[model samples]
Target: MSAHYVGQIAPNYVHSTMQANSDDDSFTFTVGKLDAGMAILIGDKASLIEFPSLLLPSGVSSGSVVNIRVMRNDQQERRQKDEFDQLQEDILHTFGQQPPKAPALRLRNVTQTSVTLEWDRLSLATATLLSLDIYRNGERLAPIPNPLHNTSTKLSGLDLNAEYTFHLVLKTTAGTLTSPLIKTRTHTISDTSGISVCFGHVAEPELLEASKQALTNMKAKWSDRIQIDTTHYVCTDPRNPGAQEGSQGAGYAKAMQLSIPAVLPHWIFACHDQKKMVGISPFYLDQDPPNASSIKRSVEEVLGKQAPASSATEADTSGSPPPPVEKEPSSATTTQDAPLKSTPFAADDVPPSNKESVGVEEVSSSAPPPPIITTSAPSEDGDAEPQSTPAPPQVVITSSESSDRIAAAAEGESTTEDAVEQTQTTEGAEEDADGEMDEVSLGGPNGDDEQEEERRSY
Candidate 1:
C-alpha cells in the first residue's frame, strides 16, 4: 500500500549532490509531492541541511500542495565509492612503473693498430642491462660485456691503410642509444729516394735544367736495373748558392746550402746482386795534381828502363803472351855448409829473356808510352836545383780492392778486406818478366781493353 500526503513541494536536490554537513553520506527523494514543513532524517553521521526548500525532496506540487517522499541517501554514497575505486586503479596503472634511461656515451684514445671504447657506469639497481655492441665501418662487431660497468675495452687487428668509423650502443631494459660515429685513419709507409747535387755558381734556370737532366738520366739508367725506385731531385739558385730551391727553381730559398753533405761526398751508384748490394761506386772526376810530371819520372827510375818497341810487336803478332813459365827451386844443404851461399838468382839480376824484354818498348808499348824526360844535375851557380828525388808517379789504379771497399762503405756495408789482404800477401809474385808488376787497373770492372774500346767507340 502507498501512503501519500498533500503539502507544498520542495526543489529537486542538486543533481547527484549530498548534504554539506555529511562527510561520507548523500540523499535523494522520489515522492510525488512534499510539504513545505516536511522533515527528512539522514544517517547519524549526516548533518542537517538549513535550506530544506532549496533541496529536492521529491514529487511535484502546485499552490503549496503537501506531499511526502522518502530520501534514499546510500545511492549517492555508492556512486562516489565506485568512482574513487576507478580513480585508484588508474593511478596505480599510470604511475606504478617507468622505463630506464640510456647510458652515458664516451670516446677513448685511438691509434693505427687499435681503438678503445668506454662508457659511464649504469644504474644496476633500477634496470637490467645486457651486452654492449660496437660497430666499425657500419659493420657490427661482437657484443662485449656490460660496457657501462666494464668502462673500457680494446679492439685490435685493424687495417693500417683504411679509414674506420666507430659506434657504441648500450642495451638496457628499455632500449638502446648509439653514440655518434667517430672517425680515424691509419698511416702508411712509402718508398723514397733522395738525390743531392752541387755545382759552381750559375744561372738558376740552367742549373735547374741540368739537375733535372742528370736526375732523369740517372733514373733511366738505374731504376730498372737497380733497387732505386723513387727519386727526389733538388736544385739551388746561383745568386744565393747556399740556398736550396725546388727542381724548377720556383720555390722559396732554403736556409742551408744544397751541396751534398761532405760525409756523403759524391753520388753513390748501386745495383742489387744476389739479394745483396754488390756493385757500388762514387761518381767523381780525377783532377791531375800539380808536379805530376816529376812524380812520373821518379816512378820510371824506380821501375827501371822499358824494353825495345820491336819486342812488344813480335809478342803481339805471335798471339797472346806465352803462358807463365815455371821456375825450378834450387837445392842447398844448409847455412852451416856455406855462409852467404850463392843463389841461382840475385836481387837485381835479370834472365836473358827478361833483359831482352826490358827496353822501354815492353813497359810503355802497350799504350802510348809516357814522354821520355831528361834530368841534369844542379849547377854550382844556382842555375838549377838538384832534381828533387824524382817524385814517384801517382799510379791511380782504379781497380784495387780498396776501391771496392770504399764503394761498399759508401753503400753502408762492410768489405772483405781480409780476403784482399791474403790475395796480395806474396810480394815478389807481383812482378812479370818485363819488370812491370801486376798493377791495380783503374779502368772499371770490365777490364782496361774493354774500357779503351768503349772510349774510342763513344
Candidate 2:
C-alpha cells in the first residue's frame, strides 16, 4: 500500500491500490503499478521519496503473491510537520535579526569596458548561509557558493562614463541579507590626453604602458624635451640631489630650473582616480608618493644638466630671451671668443672654449664701470715684437687750474697708459722739455742717446 494525497475525498488521503491479476485465492499474483507521492519534500522543491522502489526489498522476486500489511504513519507525519514549522519559525527569527555585512568592497583597474571588484567575506554560520547572490544596480546576477566565501569578479562591457552600484545578498531559508552598497563609475570614451610627460632613461616603456592601459585604457605620449607645455617626468630610478658641485643636474637646479613635475607612472593613475592633477611632489623619483617638498631636487633631475629651467616662468611674456646687453666703450684691447653651442642657456652665454670673453670696455665721460685691464697672450712668432702706442703728450703746468685739468683728464679720459690722447686746442700747455719722445727701445739703435739725455733736463 502507498500513500496518496487526495484533496477532495472525506479521508483527505488514500492508501493507493496496486494494479495486479491474481490466479487463485491462495495462488499467483502479478502486481503491475502502484501510485504514490507526498512522503517527504526537502525545501519544498525536490522530492525525497520514490514509492515505486519501496514496494519490497531489492532481492525479492517480482509478481509473487505476498501478504501485504497496510498501516498509517500518522506519528511520523506529525513529527515531520513539527520540524518544518520549527524551520519556518527559525527563518523568520533570523530574517528579523540584523544580517551580517560583508567586508570592504574594493575596485581596481577601471577601464572603458570593464572593472575589477573584490570584497572580503563574512564568517556566517553554515546553517545561516545558503548561497551568495551578486546584484548590480538592484538586479540579481550570478550566485556564488556561499556568503562566507570571499570572491572577486571582472565586470565587463559596461557603459562608458556611466556610474554603477553593486552589492551582494546572503540567501537563506530565513530571508535575504544585503551587503553594503559600493558606488563606482565606468571609464568614458575620452579623447583628452590630460598632460604631456617624458620618460627617464631607466623607465621601462612596456611595463608603464601595460600599467597605464590597465588603469586608463588610453595611449600616453612620451616627450624628449621638458617643454613649457610638458607637465610631468616619469622616472623609474632614484635621482640624486643636485647641490653637489660636480652633479650633472647641478646647473639645472641652481640656474636652469625646470618647473615640470617629476613623478612615477602611478601618479597618472592616482590623478585619474582623484579626477584632477593634485600635488605630485610626493611621487618624485627619489621621494615618496603624495609627498611635499620645498627643495625640488627632482626638478633638476628631470630637466637634466642645464640652466634657466624648462618650466614656464612668471616674467616670460613670451618664452623668448631678452635683448643682448649694449656694448660699452671702455677698452681697445678687445678679445674675441667663440659663441655658446647650446641653444638654451641661462644667466650668460657660455663660450665653446673654457676661456671666457673678458676685456676692458672704453667709455665716454659718463662711463658706468671702470675698465678692466686685459693682457694679450704671447705672440706665436718668436721674433715679432708687441705693438706699443705712444702715451698722451706730457704738459708742464705752472698754474693750479692747469694742474686740476690734468688731474681730471688723468682720472676720466685716460683709457690706457699706452694710449695718451690729448685735446689739440689748449691754451695752458708747455710741452715736455724732453721734446718729442722717441719710440726707441734698448735693443733698437740709440745713436742719439747723448742728445736725448741732454733734452730730458728742461
Candidate 3:
C-alpha cells in the first residue's frame, strides 16, 4: 500500500481494500469459520486454504464469501532497492574507505624521574578495538586503561639523564596501527626544571617570598597548596623543630606521608644561585644544620679548658696566704684534763670587764690546758690573794683542718682521729651540762676573822 493512503490507525488493525488490482490476479473464497486470527476458506477446487482474518474484507464474518487478491508491485520494490544502494554508497564515500588512524602522541611534561604523555582522541572508523598498549624502548609496558576514553597517561620512576623511546600500538579488527616513535631524554639530577614545590608553615615571610622568587628564577613550579605532582615542601628554617612537623598544616603532613621532601627555604635560594639542584639532605627540615653539632662541641671544649685557668688566676690574685699544714694529732694529745665544751663559747658570754682578764692560750697539741686563776679582793692588811681553778678544755683548731673535719663529719665519713675526738667531745659536753661547778673563795681563810675585819672596815 502507498504510504500517502495509509492513515493513523492501530498497529494490530488493517483496512478492507489494500490496493487496486486487475481481475487476472483475483480469486473467490467462501469462509467456512474463523479460528484465532486464521480463516478457513474453500476454493473452487475444494482445496482448503488458511487465510489471515486481519487481511480479509471488513465486516465479513464467519461463513461469509469474499474475493481476495494478492500481487507484488515491481515499480515500488525497484525504487526501494535503488534508495538502499544509494545510502550504502554515501556511507562508503564518507567513512568506510578509511581505516583506523594511529594515535598521535606528544609529551605534556618531562621531569628527572617521570614523563607525562597526551594524545588526540582515537578515530576507529568502523573497526572494532581489540587493545591499546604503550611501548617503551621496544618493550611493551602495559595496555592503556579505557583506551577509547582516556587520552593521557603518566610514566614514572625513570632514570635521570637517560634516553628513552616511546610509542603507542593500537590493535583493532581491521589491522594494527602504531604511532610514530618519540625519542626523549630525562632531565639530569641537577636540573631545576623538574622541581615542583608546595609551601608549608613558613615562619619567615621574607624567606618565603625570597624562596618563591628563587623558584621563579630557577624555572621551577611552586604552589601554596600541595598536589599529587608536588615534589618538595618548603617551610621554616631547618634548624627549628617546628619545621619538621608541628607547625605545618594538613597539606604539609600529607606531603610528608607521600614521601615528598620537606626542605628549608635556603634550599630554593641555593638551587637558584647554583643554577642547578643540590643535595636535600643538608636542607631537610628534620635534620640539624650541617656542622652545627661539631661547632657546639668545639665551643664546649674551649670553655671547659678556660674554666680551670680562670679559677687559678683568681686564687693567685687573693693576698691571704694558705694555712700551714699540721701533723696528725697523736692519741695521747691533750689528755682530757677537764670536761671540754662541745661547742665554742660565745665571746659575748664573758663580761666586758673580764674579757681582758681572760686569756686564750694556744698550747701544743700534746699539752694540757692551764688552770684558771681568780684573784681575791685586797685585804685590810693591803695584800691581794689569788685562787686557782680548772678551766674548760679548749681545742686549737686550724682553718683548713677544721673545714675538712666539719665537712667529713657532715657527710658521716669522718676519719679515725675525728671519731675519737668526737667521742671525747660528746662526753665532755655531757659532763659540763650535768655536773655542778665548784665555788672559788677570794675571802680570808677564817670566816669569823673575815666577818670581824669587814665589821671593823665598815
Candidate 4:
C-alpha cells in the first residue's frame, strides 16, 4: 500500500529514514540521496499519532512518542506551484545564474606581450549579475570587473607565438555553465628595429615563430593585432586599404595599404643576408622566394650598387683570368664551352700539324679538366692596387707519389717553376696528416705549355 502510494505521488524517489527516539519526542537520522524523497515524505496527508504500545518510543500521548508527522493546517510551501518555481528562478538569477548562453570570443589584436579579446554580451548575463568568471587555460583570471557587462577585454603579459585557451563561466546555486574554449596564439615580429609587423589570421604559425626569432635578432617587433605604428603587414594576401572598414580584418589591411610596402620572404632573407632593411620592389614573392642569387642582386641594389653589365668577352672578376678552354671530359660530342681569352700564339709557337690553332683554341682530346688552382702570388705593388686579387691563375700539377710533374703534355720533364730553365729549390717540403707530401698542383688546359707551369709543390 505504501509502495503504491509512493508510485502515484513520487514515482522516482526514495523512502526517507527517521529514528523514533523517546527523548522529548525528538529523533535524528539522515535522508537518502533522492531529490523527491523528502518532498514526497512531506505529503498533505502526513500525520503524527501515538505509536502502538509494542513499537519503539511507545507512549499514550502523541507528544510522548515520535511518529510520521503532518504539516499544520495553516502551513504550505506557497500559495501556488508557479509562485514557488518563480521564487526558485528568481534566487538563481539573483546569484548570476540567469541561464547564460556560451560566449563566442573573437580575436581582436595580438601583440608579442598581449592579446585583445572581443565577445558579445549574453542575454541571461546582465550588468548587475553575479561574477562572470574569465579563465585562461582553465586557470581563473581576475580583474575584469563583476557583472562583466563589457563586451571586450584585453589580456596582457603573454608569450610570443604561443598558444592560449580561454572561456567564460557563471557560477550560482543553480549549477555551473561555461563558455566553449577559444584557443589562439600570439604573433612574433620580423624585424624589431625596422618594421612593426602585424600577422594576419591566414599567416603560417611556423613562419610567424621563425620570423619572430629572426626579427627579434634583427631588433624588430611582431604584433598579433595591428597598432597605429605598425609599418608592415606579413601575409600571403593582404586586402586593399579602406576595404571592409571596422571589420576584424579591415583595420589590419588598412595598415598594410600602399604607403607601406608589402614584403616577401625573399625580402626577409635578403634583408638578413644584407644586414639592412631591403626594399620590396622586386623581392615580392607571388610564389616561393626567388633563387638566392637573384635575391643577392636585389639586396645589392638596395645597398646602392649599380648592377654590373654583361660583356661579350666575359672577364673573371677574380684576378688571374681563367686559363684557355679545354675539351670537356668527353670529346665524342661538341660543347659550347668557352675558354679563357688569350693573345694569339705565334705560328712557330703552335705545333706544325695544327698551325691554325692560336689564341684561345680548345685543347684536343686526351686533355683532362684543368688542374685545381692551388696558390696565387700577389702582383708587384705597381700603380694598380691588385683590384681584389682575381682568382689565382692555375698552378702546376705534380704527382703526390713522386716529384714528377703530371700534366696531359708535361709527360716527361724536370719539374720547374715558370720562367726557369733550371729547378729552384722545392722549399718548405712538408707532409700532410695522411703521411703524403703537402704537394700543391695548378694545371690548366695548356697541358704541354711548360711556360704555363709555375711552381710545383709535392
Candidate 5:
C-alpha cells in the first residue's frame, strides 16, 4: 500500500476543541485494524506500534492524511552510550601506553668531590611512583629516597679525575620509567700535598698560574710526592683557621696536618739547604711514630740511596735526580740515635764510585767574603746595645747543584770535600758586611757589585 504524505508537524500544542454543538468539531481514531508492526502518526512524526491502539482528538476534516514510520528508540540510545564509553577507554589507554617524559636534568654547583642533580617530576596519575635510582657510568648506584618533586639531590664521594654519567629512573607501580641520560665529566681533584702547599696563601692570578706550572713540574718529576686517595685539591681557597701574617706558614702547616687524616697517610716535608736535602717525617697522633728507620726506608723508596747530604747537594738544580739506591746503615752510626740509628739505609751504603761521581765542590768559592761590623743603637735604659738585623738573602746551593759538580769533580779526581769547603768559605765571606752594607757588599766576587750599588742608590 502507498503511504500518504502529510504536512509538517507544528511545535505548538493545542488540547482544546471547537465550540460546536455537533460532534464534527472533534476527530477520533484507533489502531485497532492496523498490522502488528505498523507505525502510526498524528501528523508528520510517527511512533512504531505492535498491535497497539492510540486515539486522536475529533476534527471536522474527513480527508486528512497522517504519516506513519518506524522508529528504533532503544537501539539508538544503546549506540550512543557505547560510543561514549569507548571514547573514555581510549583516553585512559593512551595515557598508559605513552612513555614517561623526563625534563632536562641539570647538575648545579658542581665541585671536585660533589655535585647536585635535579629534574622535573613525572606526572603519570595512574601509577604510584616510589624512589628514584641514580646511575654512574653503567653501574647502578643507591636510589635516592623520597626525591623532592622539584628540587635536586646532592651526590657525594665522587672521584674528581674520573668522568661520570648520571641519570634517574623512577620506580612505579606498573613498571620502572627511565629518564634521558646526562653525561658530565668530573673536575680533577689534585693530590693533597698540592692543596696543603697552597693553603692560606692568597692565590692571585699570577700566583695561581705559577702554582699550576709548578704543580705540573712536580707531578712530572716527583709523582710520589702526592697521595692518590684521601686527597682533594680544588681551585678554591677556603679560609684557614687562626691565620695571621707572621703565623701564616704555621697556619698552612696546621691545615695540612688536619687534612692529612682525611687525605694523606704518608707525608713528609722535604727541607733543602746548601748542604743537603732532608725529609722531616710527618707526625700523626694515631699512627706509629715516624722514626729515622722508617724515614730512611721511605726516602730510599722515593728518592734513592745516594749519600743523603752529598749526592743531593751536588745534584743539578735544573734536572731531575737519578733514582736512589737502597743501602744498609753503617755499623759505626748504628748507635747514633733511636731515630737515626734504626735506619737500614745510610750515606756510606751508597756507592761512592757510581756512574757519575757527584762533586763536593765549594759552591761559593767564586764569591769573596765581606767584612762584618756591629752597630749599637741607644736602648730605653740609655745604654748602647747591638741591634740585630737579617742578613741579605743569599744564593743557597741546592743538592741538585751539588750532584752536578760531583760527577765533574770525580772526573778530575779532585777531592769533593775540598770543593765543598771552598764554596762554604766564599758563602761565609759574602754574608759579612759593614753598617748597612747595601747590595754591593752582599754580592759574590764575580757578581756585578757596581751595578748592584747603582741600583741600590736609585
Candidate 6:
C-alpha cells in the first residue's frame, strides 16, 4: 500500500512466487504511461499504481507488460544497520571519546602596571588545534603564538592597582573550549614586594651586598640581566671607572634604553626601613641626596615664626637679650583721654601695687628699662601681617565687653578678620569712661618711692 521504499531492493531477492499468499505478494501489470519521474501501471483488476520511472526495467516502453512485486526485506535492513554501527564506533575511537579540553589559567606575578599569567599545557586530546586566544574583560586581547609550546604570558601597559578579568579560549577540530575566568589586581605603588631590582654599575661591593640583603628583607626580587620583568636598576655613578664594562655595565645601557628607574642603593635601604615602596625620583643615581637641615630651613621660611610667650617672666629670662629700642611714640598724648592710646609713661607714674601687671620686674642691673611693645590688631585680610608699634607703658583697664572681644580673637571664635576688626572698634568706644578712672587710679601719691624703685630695677 505504501509507495516509498526505505531498504535496498536487489535482483537476487526477487522471485516470481511465494509459498504463502502468492496472489497478494506478486502481481502482473501493464505500463499505462511514463512521465518524467513516475511510471503508471495498470494491474489485472485495472488498479493503477504510481512507481518511479528510474526503478522500472531499462528500455521498457509505454504499454509494456511488467511484473510488480512488493515484499519486506528484513535481511537487507539488518545488514545496512550493522554497517552504520561500525562506522559510528570507528569515529568514537578516533576523535569522539576524548575531545579538546578547556585551557587552565592562573596569575603568576602582579606589579604596578603589569601582570604575569601562566596556564597548564593545552589538552588537544588527539584533535587538531586551530588557534588559541586570550581574552581580558570579555574582549579578545591577543592570539597565542605556537599555542602548544607556550604556556605563560606577560601583559604590560595595565592600570596601577586596578582589577582585571582574564580567560583563555582554545579552538580545535573537536570544538571551541574556554577556561575559567581569573580575577587579578595589580600591585599598588606602596607595595614593595612587587619591586624587581637589577644590579648595575655599583662601585662599592659592600653597597651592592647591602642592597641585595635589603631586597631580600623586603621580599623583592632581583636579577643580573635586564629583562622585561626588571623594574628598577640599582647602581652607583655610571660615569665611574669600569662602569661601562660587561656589555654596557651589566645592563645599564639596556635599562636606559628601556627607561627603567635607575636608582641608587639607598632606595632599597629606605624601602626596607619604611616597609613600603618610596618614590624613585628623589633617589635617582644622577641626583644628590636631600639634606635634612636644608629641608627644615625651607619649611620655617614658609610658615614664619611662632607666637611669643604670654608670661613676662618667661620672655625676660629668655637666652636672647631684649630687642633694641626703635623709634618711640610721643609723650604728649595723655592717658586720661585715650586709655589704650600709644603714649610714653614716666617710671614714676605707675602705682607700686600694679607694677607687676605692667610687665615690669625689679632687676639688679643698670640697663635701661625695656620698652613696651603693643602690637596692632591684624588687618581684615587673613594673611596680612600684624603691625607692631613701640609705645611706652600706659594704664589700660579693659571693660568686660572689651575683654570678651579680645578673648574671642585669641580663641579663634570668629574666623573672619573683618569680625576681629569690628570687635576692636567697638571695644575702643566702650573704654572712654573706664580709661579716665584707670589713669587716675594708677597715678599714685608716692611719686618719689616709685622713681626710686624704678631706678633700682634699671
Kindly give the number of clashing pairs for every candidate. 22, 17, 0, 19, 36, 0
lDDT by residue (13-45, candidate 2, tens digit) is: 222222212432121123333334212211112
Model 4 C-alpha lDDT per residue in residues 192-231, reported as the tens digit of each score:
2535676654344444455555566566677766664465
- The list of candidate 6 runs beyond 4 A from truth reads 1-98, 226-228, 237-250, 253-259, 289-357, 360-458
| lDDT by residue for model 3 (195-266), tens | 888887776555566667667766889987766567788876322323553444676668768788888666
What are the Cα lDDT values of the candidates? 0.38, 0.43, 0.60, 0.45, 0.40, 0.61
lDDT of 6 at 422: 35
**Against the hidden true structure, what lDDT does model 4 obtain?**
0.45
| Residue-by-residue lDDT tens digits, candidate 6, 12-86 | 322322222355555566788998799997765466767788877777779887765556798878898999999
Choose 2 or 3, whichever is better by TM-score: 3
Model 5 vs truth, CA RMSD:
25.5
Worst 10 residues of 4 by lDDT: 1-10
lDDT of 3: 0.60
Model 3 residue runs over 4 Å out of place are 1-98, 146-149, 199-205, 223-230, 233-259, 289-458
Question: Residues 246-266, candidate 5, lDDT per residue (tens digit)?
Answer: 432443354467463221112
TM-score of 2: 0.25
| Number of the candidate with higher TM-score, 3 or 6 | 6
Which of candidates 1 and 4 is the stronger one according to lDDT? 4
Candidate numbers, best lDDT first, in rank order? 6, 3, 4, 2, 5, 1
- The candidate scoring highest on lDDT is 6
Model 2: CA > 4 A from native: 1-112, 126-128, 145-147, 187-458
Instruction: List where candidate 5 sits over 4 angstroms from the true fold.
Output: 1-99, 102-104, 148-150, 189-458
lDDT of 5 at 351: 25
Question: Highest TM-score among the candidates is held by which one?
Answer: 6
- lDDT score, candidate 5: 0.40
**What are the candidates' C-alpha RMSDs?**
28.4, 22.0, 30.2, 21.8, 25.5, 22.2
